[model samples]
Target: DQQVKQNSPSLSVQEGRISILNCDYTNSMFDYFLWYKKYPAEGPTFLISISSIKDKNEDGRFTVFLNKSAKHLSLHIVPSQPGDSAVYFCAASEGRGSNYKLTFGKGTLLTVNP
Candidate 1:
């Protein structure tokens, strides 16, 4: 069974608009959430991550929000640009330690129209 899920398979946004990607998890044990961005023919790179202890985390133009009670999380990109277009994967881990297994969602393709 997939523990993490990205309901929207794709999202299209105009350049300079805000792009929001949503994710949900069935596992309550998850304590950490991570978002990865992948470009065509390239490896997925870590974009931003949030710990369950906090409701939100921000880095540059990207921000991630966690709602533990709802078992949901979302990533927001401000002033979306063509360069920001990519497949975004939502990942989660049971704990912060090394032994925890990571679970990943299928990913949501984000297209920023310029």
Candidate 2:
């Protein structure tokens, strides 16, 4: 059973628009949620993260929202630029020190039309 799931396979948006990516999890043990962006051939690079204790976290143009009660989370990119077009994977893991492994979604391919 996949713990983390991204229902949408892809998303398209204008270069200056907002991109919203959704993610869901079935495991309640997950205490941390993260979003990673991957290029065509490059490794996934971490974008934003939120702890179970908080409902939201923001970094510059990226914002991550977590709804622990529903086991749901979302990543929002405002004014998405052309370079922001990439595959985004939502990952989850337990708290630090438990040596937990991350569970990742299939990924959503984001296309920012120039």
Candidate 3:
């Protein structure tokens, strides 16, 4: 079973609008959640992350909100631009870097129309 799930396979938004991507998880052991953005041919780049202890984390125009009790998380991009179009992924880990592996969601393709 996929511990991390992005129910929406894709999303489309107009430039300067807000783009929201949602994710869900089944594993309660997950203590950390991360969001990554991937271009066509490059690898996924880390965008932001939140610990189970915090409900929100933000970096510039990107903000990630975590609802621990609901096992849900979402990434929000303000003033979305065409360059922001990419595949967004949600990842979860058990908080142990030494031996833990991150579980990734299928991914949500975001299209920011110019």
Candidate 4:
């Protein structure tokens, strides 16, 4: 039933500022979006992706945005530092291959309070 939702489990920013992370999906057949970080030991990696026909996508400072009719998606980190904190997983898939399965969202603990 949880087609993916990271309803602000946690988020604190400071270091350099700017760190917005949010994701929601009711499964509109998705399209593609991924943003993983996870660090406290190392695992999740990725860290940027968006393809729902393209709403926005960057890499340098990390940026990903998609609003396929408001299914919602976001991940922006500008000056945020402190190793970029961790725990940020919001994945989805429904393209590029047909069925690899990737629907995750239950992570959003990005704390970078220098």
Candidate 5:
């Protein structure tokens, strides 16, 4: 079973528009949620994160909202730029510990049209 799922494999948007990416998880034990952005061959870079204790977390142009009750989460980018075009991976982990193993979604590729 896929504990995490990104229903949309790709999204296209005009530059300076809002980009929204959605993710869902079935595991109730996942406590830490994170969004990572990846470009072509480079490794993923952490964009933002939210603890299960909190419902939302934001950093500059990036915002992540988590609905613990619904087992869902979403990432929003305001005024999305061409530079923001990349593959976004939603991941979950138990917590910060030895047993922490990140479970990643298939990924959502965002294309910002210039």
Candidate 6:
């Protein structure tokens, strides 16, 4: 079973619109949640994160909400721009410890058309 899954492999939206990405996890032990954005070849860069302690976290143009009971998380980008076109990955890990290993979902590729 996939511990983490991004059901949509890709999303496309017009520029200056809202882009939403969804993610789901089955592991209840995951306490740290993160979202990363990746360009063509470079590694993913951290976008935002929310601990199991919080239900929401937001960055400049990005926002993440976590629903612990449902084991679901979503990323929202308001007024999405062309630069936002890339693959987004949802990651999860346990609290800092030896067992802490970052697990990533396949990814959702978002394309913003101008």
lDDT of each: 0.96, 0.95, 0.96, 0.91, 0.96, 0.95
Q: Which pairs of residues have clashing backbones in candidate 4? A: none
Q: Would you list the clashing residue pairs of candidate 2?
A: none
List, residue by residue over 33-103, the lDDT tens digit for candidate 6.
Answer: 99999999899998999999999988888999999999999999998999999999999996778868899
lDDT value, residue 55 of candidate 4: 97
Segments in model 4 whose C-alpha atoms lie over 4 Å from true places: 1-14, 17-31, 34-49, 52-56, 59-76, 81-87, 95-102
TM-score of 6: 0.96
Tell me the TM-score of each prediction against the true structure: 0.97, 0.97, 0.98, 0.33, 0.97, 0.96
RMSD (Å) of each candidate, 1 decimal:
0.7, 0.8, 0.6, 11.4, 0.7, 0.9
Residue 5, candidate 6: alpha-carbon lDDT: 96
* Quality of model 1 by C-alpha lDDT: 0.96
The residue pairs in collision within model 6 are none
The candidate, 4 or 5, that scores higher on lDDT is 5
Worst 10 residues of 2 by lDDT: 94-103
- Winning candidate number (TM-score): 3
Candidate scoring better on TM-score of 3 and 5: 3
Model 4 vs. true fold: TM: 0.33
Candidate 1 C-alpha lDDT tens digits along 9-87 = 9999999999999999999989999999999999999999999999999999999999999999999999899999899
lDDT of 6 at 62: 92
Worst-scoring 10-residue span by lDDT in model 1: 93-102
Question: Which residue pairs in candidate 3 collide?
Answer: none
TM-score of 2: 0.97
Regions of candidate 3 where Cα sits further than 4 Å from its true position: none
Model 2 lDDT at residue 37:
98
